[model samples]
Target: MGRNTRKRRTPLATKAIAASAALALGGGGLIWANFYASAHESNNNAWGNQTKAANAQVATISCPDIGQKLTSVPRQARTEVDGELGNLDRQITDAYQRLMTTRDAQARDASFVQNSILQPLKDRRKAIIDRIKLEINRVGGSAPGSLDTLASCTGTPANQTTAGGQQQQNGGQQQQNGGQQQQNGGQQQGNTGQQQGNGGQAGNGPVAADFVDITKVQPNVAAKPQKSGNASTGVFITRCGVNANKNHNTDNVIVAPGVTNGAHHLHDYVGNQKVNAFSSNQTFLQGGTSCQNKNDLSAYYWPVVRVQDGTQDFDQNADGGGKEGNVGKILTPVQAQIKYVGSPTSKVVAMPQFLRIITGDAKTTTNGLANANAHWSCTGFENKVQLTTQYPICPQGSNVVRTFAFQSCWDGQNIDSANHRTHVAFADANGNCQNGFKAIPQLTMRLVYQVTPPTVQNGVVKNAFAVDGFPEQLHKPATDHDDFISVTTGGLANKIANCINNGQRCA
Candidate 1:
């Protein structure tokens, strides 16, 4: 009405022109409007995408106390493009690798013979551990605990105490065998030998965590009594060595707490404070995600500890290429320079001269290079003073363990019958193997003086670290007992004859 009220008709060509003009005006307006609408819609889409990504940057790690749950300690947000995640991840991963090495050694020395079998395994395991630790350290807040660190710290334990006594005894039997794994950690253990390691899990004498001084502790022969007054010696004919078939023999030095069955990498030597660990050697039964099926070795299990005394023939192949062997020999000058920072026990004896071996032993094969990892490598483990702590703290949390133990096996030789050399070691004022006892199995055990009460402290669980090892054993032969009869040319023969004729076994 405002623009076109008249029905104006003119010549036919003129009228067509007017209609075309009107169509052009409406078409132009619609076209311009469409362009504006498209531009506005695109801007909305771009902003939506930006907002979504901002939200995706992180999800809070819930610490209800913090308005935003803290995944980390309130660090800046990281994104795939920024490479922040990878940076944080690398550090944590390195720590995991170091810890793996510590765990591997502890597992290797579960028993005396176990180390021989576990040496190679420990190497491979260390490599794997380094890689794993690297991954773990890179990521923040992994399975936080010391369980893994304490499990793998190797070498002879500082405190290997005895509940009964710390010594091995010989039976009067002629035929004997000695058992020792050179610490390569065997590729495979035969079923027959395996039965004795894991409790009734393996066989008759599962390796307990106790290695005794063969020369120090004597056996009760359990022979027929010759004396008028005396009770029988209780130790005679008790289980000697354990086997996978449940058979035991005193003919061999059974690796204490060796694998009649193995729990592998056991954590919580005392109880409660568990650190993070990585391995398949966790608990087979109920436990956390980190728990693995493994073989466990502890000073508490085998109270007897053996420090290497001397060597006439020690093959580098044995001792995990010095993984368990003492390769450091002080030069005459260097040793003289060592000053006693504190006093050693007056009861302590000096290390016998016979204990030293060739210094360059296992030089090439078992070098620490093979064990280098960011986590707990053997490199960080040493008998030296810590440069940082100035104490003997292993660099990694996995460096030293309170429950760590020494390894030993019976060479199946008679303690009474054979001429054998033995080495002994003990802890001084500080828990260290500085003091050597002048005896075979020439070592003194670090016994625990402080007993830890199993109570939660101040509503916070407190874990105690205690030194553990042997209480020493009686080193005497039976004077008079039924099994202490005089050895006659035919005394042994008569017992055999009686058993055979009676269809019974010898007592």
Candidate 2:
């Protein structure tokens, strides 16, 4: 399951409703309503502010194969990349906290500004970006475009160079709001008043910690390893085909067909050797397998979530241009689950090859309506649901888990639907498949991330996690999608029936 983090502004209509309520209530009641509305609005703003700073610090980094990139990256390479990013994250978090707590520096001279924040921020950011580029290239991927990492800082009060491009000291004279500050040898800094740089710390634009760290409040809950062959429990299994080798390519005709790198997004796929944008049932059955069980060939896939490097190139939405559907870093899933679910009397039936089922909608033009079913939880705190872009930051010993449940009730005929969803419906709360709809094997993916939560300050929650998708989309709990194919041989399907119906645990 993957998604993008976009700030959800209170709709104008919602705001109007709040205002109307305030007017009808009158006086103190109005005060409470207004306060509630303001707090509600602030939550979105806070997330927006934190995300802005976070993305800027990530700077111009390129992740090749953008879709299947993370999973394809070597395990050691991923750990190194995360370490580099985690360090930058910590630095930015510190700088943000400092800027938030520091007094306004409008009265401070450029020299003090340079030493206190600007220089350190620029030097640290440059080093991190350089390191990331080096690491990506080291792993056989192309390095990001060469950039003047400090270009954004050129016009700031500190780091301004002379007309001759020479380092200079200012005359220590106070300049007007839009006037040039005179430098040595008759040079002058530009009249652009305190431009916002890559490092969002300037005279009046001191960076504030937009989110409070919530790690302490929600401690981590460790997962106990599942024992095998308990016989008292039932399990479902999906033997997916080959791991999708490329990121942007797809074979699913329902979503995109014959489109190479056409998703303008990335996705991770398992199952169906011929899986791509144009794949059909015939192609899927002929494809090879990536799964250990060669007899069970099926397709399973979902979007990829990347960690943004400072370049802001991951998604078009992150840059304020919503033309493309998804951009930014694509994160890999932590774990996955596949099983057959039906009534006690029902038995497992092989689903048609290339049968496509998408659970979460990825192409959400709006924020709230998409990702309606995406589920996020702490390993031990499964009941506490997290729905926003700021994914849960699990406490020590616990992991961040994402769960996607696909519809199991198929129409018994159509392998696909126009909307890519209607062909199936979810199993009932009692775990019973719907009437008339045949219960096929249900595939659920549970992805876990081991990440320390951002330090919460002032009671605000800061999210350290970012998902994969269009940055303009909300990435709410609903964007998670899952696809499946049935390659289960007749014998394997019966085995599933015996194991599940008889209440015997088998994996």
Candidate 3:
């Protein structure tokens, strides 16, 4: 679809703020409609009334991940197909906004959501899907007939039972469990009449239940695999300053190339300085670097974290910021550690130039946990526990941490894949590359932040922090992700592999 044909809808921030105010003024029927229920909630409901209420609390739209399903997009048609995928995302975002603002209508009629919001959204998606098929067929590639099946989306419930047995409320607040709250995995904590608060300043998410006291979580880190005699046991570290240059944008060049505001959320970038949706392989090769070693021109980026303290940033009214329901002050990480380590089972190979890797799923809240890989913890408790869904409430003097471990196995032939994932895979349990894949140096990133802990009192959260995400994702911690593009010179790539395979550490 052309830009001129796209309908201009009201910004989500404006609608969300207005809806929140209306709900605050005793509009009991109004609710934030995009909240995701916990995955465990479906199996643990015991109360009939609670279950009924949960069913009626239609919170989010769950649709098939078309990008994931297209594992065979032809190279000739990828650009057009990717644009259509981006359009599909925009359609969902608009539909989610309409659902959020029409709580009154939903309360009045049982089928209001299906008839007015979901059906229209499905029709739009079908058109986009058809366009994708046409693009593929034009390039002499066969498109799957099942592509049409992914057009329809269903409403997901709002309330879910946490692993600790506590229930989520219609407004995305944690319902107190008698006088105690359950932590993840059935752990119990005592607290009565405590409401975590409504989702952050945007009124969408990072609810109180989304945060847990890090001290209470048990140690769950797994032991590293033991190295064998022939295993590559070296490490290579890179000093890429934590986005100090303030290179931030909402464009995802690897996924939605040429589409402005393609990501719909702000990303803090380091390394290659001239990257955006329009950037090509040539642009990356010529871009300046943030790494201490100028030879490494790779780009590393992840969503920017924000503090919801009623403060507005430079993009307060912009498409990927407040307008998309990502509000508050953007935070720069206190420290960023980028390291690459050799495979545990075999000698490593140099990565192909321009290899693109995306770790973690940005839509995990709605897509489920198959691709979810967010690791959140506090400084002092690093080895004790890591969280995938909930944000950590760090203790005083202990900073918050976000970690990403990228895929280490490559197919040896393709630098990229249709879904951007099939080209690379994680090593198996035995640390061996599966199929015909080759082991490569694993990239691990650790980012630390100094943030004030948020508190929930009387159903209000103060100074809460959240990861930037798509508007419909509601800034859930589970949706946190990272992206990387390798633009290393052949010599530098060889040096990295030698450093690792030779069992030596280098920077």
Best by TM-score: 3
> What are the lDDT scores of the predictions, listed in order?
0.18, 0.39, 0.73
- lDDT per residue for candidate 2 within 1-507, as digits (tens), equals 111111111122122122221221110010000111122222111211322212112111111111111223333354455455445433433443343333234123324333565457667867866776677678786543543342123111211111101111136221111112111111111122111221111111111111112232232222222333422235656544223344333223444444443343455776545566556567766776666676666666666543322223434442111223233334454555555543433554546645667665543212222223455556776643333222444567887676765665677876654334555665543444565777665566676666555333322112223444432222222344455555555476567656765666566
Candidate 1 has an lDDT of 0.18
Query: 1-507, model 3: which lDDT tens digit per residue?
Result: 111111111122112212222222121111222223353544223222333223335546777889887778889999999998888888888887786677666656657777898889899999999999999999999888899999998765444312112222345322322212222221111122112333567766656656667776656565666787879989999999999879999999988898898899999998999999999999999999999999999999999999887778999899999888888889999999999998888999998899999988888656754565678889988776677656788989999999988888888988877777888887765677777889988999999999998885443456789999888776777688999999887499889999999999999
RMSD of each: 37.2, 19.4, 10.4
Better of 1 and 3 by TM-score: 3
What TM-score would every model get versus the actual structure? 0.15, 0.49, 0.83
Candidate 2 vs candidate 3: the lDDT winner is: 3
Model 3: residue 216 alpha-carbon error in angstroms: 0.4
Off by over 4 Å in 3: 1-56, 160-197, 458-460
Better of 1 and 3 by lDDT: 3
**Runs in model 2 lying further than 4 Å from the true structure:** 1-233, 238-252, 309-330, 342-350, 363-371, 383-390, 452-463, 474-477, 489-491
- Candidate 1 stretches with Cα past 4 Å from truth are 1-199, 202-507
Ranking by TM-score: 3, 2, 1
